[model samples]
Target: MTRSESVRRAGIENKPSSAEMDNIYYTAQQLDTKLLSASIIGWE
Candidate 1:
């Protein structure tokens, strides 16, 4: 959780769009469909 919006405050806001988020949340682990897919794995 170290890397979040807070950490990205220094750099660019690297996050998927609202529609993309819906797809990611809906789809399985089949990410990377987009050129810059925002696929994240949560162990916790």
Candidate 2:
């Protein structure tokens, strides 16, 4: 599945709101440290 699809699925499974996902994606993008999925995994 695509990254967004994965993120959405994770959100459903983990119960994090969309806003949290957006924040994570934005912060990770600014840092250029890792893919959003990696950050999401770390968050979990």
Candidate 3:
């Protein structure tokens, strides 16, 4: 399923607190950086 669909299915439409948003953004950024690094390293 698409990300939006997954979020909708999980019922995350309710507004999240600033701290929650911050944490989510932080985690996403970290994951993105790690993925980029892994790609650069050409790892399996």
Candidate 4:
């Protein structure tokens, strides 16, 4: 699934651009944490 989709699934109404979302996913992968949903959702 795309990062946008994943973020949406996490219940974030406002979202960043596709590029920004991709960067977040990439950074999360680098950190090896399951904070993808938490981090993005928390930004809301």
lDDT of each: 0.63, 0.75, 0.91, 0.78
Candidate number of the best lDDT: 3
The regions of model 4 sitting more than 4 angstroms off are 1-13, 33-44
Task: For each candidate, give its TM-score against the true structure.
Answer: 0.34, 0.39, 0.64, 0.41
Tell me the lDDT of candidate 4: 0.78
In model 1, the runs with Cα more than 4 Å from the true position are: 1-10, 29-44
lDDT of 1 by residue, 1-44 (tens): 46676668778677889999988886744543442353334322
- Lowest lDDT sum, 10 consecutive residues, model 1, at 35-44
Q: Which wins on TM-score, candidate 1 or candidate 2?
A: 2
Tens digit of per-residue lDDT, candidate 2, span 1-44: 98778978778555558999899888878767555557788853
- Write down the TM-score for model 2: 0.39
Whole-structure CA lDDT of model 3:
0.91
Total residue pair clashes for candidate 3: 0
Task: Let me know the TM-score candidate 1 reaches against the reference structure.
Answer: 0.34
- How would you encode candidate 4's per-residue C-alpha lDDT over 1-44 as one tens digit per residue? 99878888999886578999999989879776556656876842
**Model 3: per-residue Cα lDDT over 1-44, one tens digit each:** 99878898999896778999999999999999999999999965
